[model samples]
Target: MTDEHPHRPRLAPLPEDGWDPSARELLAPIPRDADGRLPHVFTTLVRHPGLFRHFLPFGTHLLRHGRLAGRTRELLILRTARNTRAAYEWGRHVPLARAAGVTDEEIRRVGAGPDAPGWTPADALLLRAADELHREARLSAATWSALAADHDEAQLIEITMLVGQYHMVAFFLNSAGTPLEPGFTTEALPAATGTADDDA
Candidate 1:
C-alpha cells in the first residue's frame, strides 16, 4: 500500500477544553474508550453539533440496526476504506469485522478485492459493488441482480447506503485529519498486492 496521505487537518478534532455544553451533551452517551473519550471522528465532528446531531442516528442505524448481516456490512465497510484510502476508517472497522466472524484471511482478501481467490459469488458481488459505487456512484445491472438474488429490498438499500456513508466518513476523516486515538492498536488494512489496493 502506498500509505500516501499528504493532507493535513483543515479543521482538527476539537480539543477537550473547547467542548461546549451542547457538544458535551451530544458526546456523553456515545461509547468511549478507557480514557472516557470518544473517537477522534466523534470529537472532531462534535465541533459542528448540528451535523453531529443529525449524523448520529443515521450512522448508528447503519452500524447497529441495519438489515445487512454483520459480516456483510463489514466487508462493504472495509472495501470502502480500501477504495478511499481512509486510514482511520479502515483501522476502526477491522475489529468489528473480526467480531462479525470475518477471519484474518478474509480481511486480507478484502484489500485484494472481490476477485481474489476463495470469495464466494455473493461475496464478490459485495466488493465489486463497493468498487463500482466508489468509481461511478452506481451499480451495474449484473451486480444489482446478483445482490438481489440473496438480499431483500431493505438489505439492498442498506448496501448502497452503507458504502456511500463510509465514503462520506472517509472524506471527513481524510479532510479533517482525524487522527487515530492514542493507544489504539489494530492491524492496518492489508497492503496492496494489486491495483485494487493502493492503500487502506
Candidate 2:
C-alpha cells in the first residue's frame, strides 16, 4: 500500500570511508528483493555506518542461518510487530509467516492477543513471553516458567534475542515513519480502537 506518509526522509547509501566495502559486499550477496529494497525506516539506519554494521551481522545471521524453526521465529516477530505497531514489520513478515506454514487465520489471531481462540497452549506461551518482554522489558516469573517448560536454554536465549531484535527494528520503523510494502497493511486488532480491550 502506498504510505499515507511518504514524504519522510529517504536514507542514502552507506559511504565507504567509514566501513569496509568488502563487508558490505559480503552482505550484499544477499541483495534485497524488489520488495526488500523498497526503502523503509531500516535503510535510514545505514546513514551511520557503524550502527549499520553492528546490526547487519545479527540480521544476516537470523535471516540467513539462525537455527530456530521458522514458526517459532515468526511467532516472536509477529508479536513484536503487533506490540510495537510496526507496519513495515507486519507487512513483511505476514507473508513469511504463511510461507512457514502459519495459516492465514492463525496469523490474523496474532493481533487478537492472549484471548485469541484456537491458539495452542504453546503458542499462547510464546506470544505471552514476547508480550511480557516488550511491555516490561523482562519476563514475569510465570512467563519464564512456561517458557522454560517448553524451551531449552539455547532456544530460550534465541527467543529472547529475537524479541529484542524485533523490538529495536519496530522502534526504528515507527519512529522514522517507515513505509509499509505495496498492498500490505497492519491487520486491525480485534478491538478496532487504538487501544486493546484490556486497556480499559
Cα error, candidate 1, residue 131 (Å)? 0.8
RMSD, each candidate, Å? 2.6, 4.7
Report residue 181 deviation for candidate 2 (angstroms): 2.9
lDDT for model 2? 0.70
TM-score of each: 0.91, 0.79
Per-residue lDDT for 1-200 in model 2, tens only?
Answer: 12233355343334335436644554454456465552444445665557766787898788657877889899889877877767778878888898888888888888777657799998888888787787778888897888888788887788888999998887777666666655565544223322222321
Best by TM-score: 1
Q: Runs in model 2 with CA error above 4 Å?
A: 1-27, 34-42, 183-200
Error of 1 at 67 (Å): 0.7
Q: Number of clashes in model 2?
A: 2
Question: Can you list the residue pairs that collide in candidate 1?
Answer: none
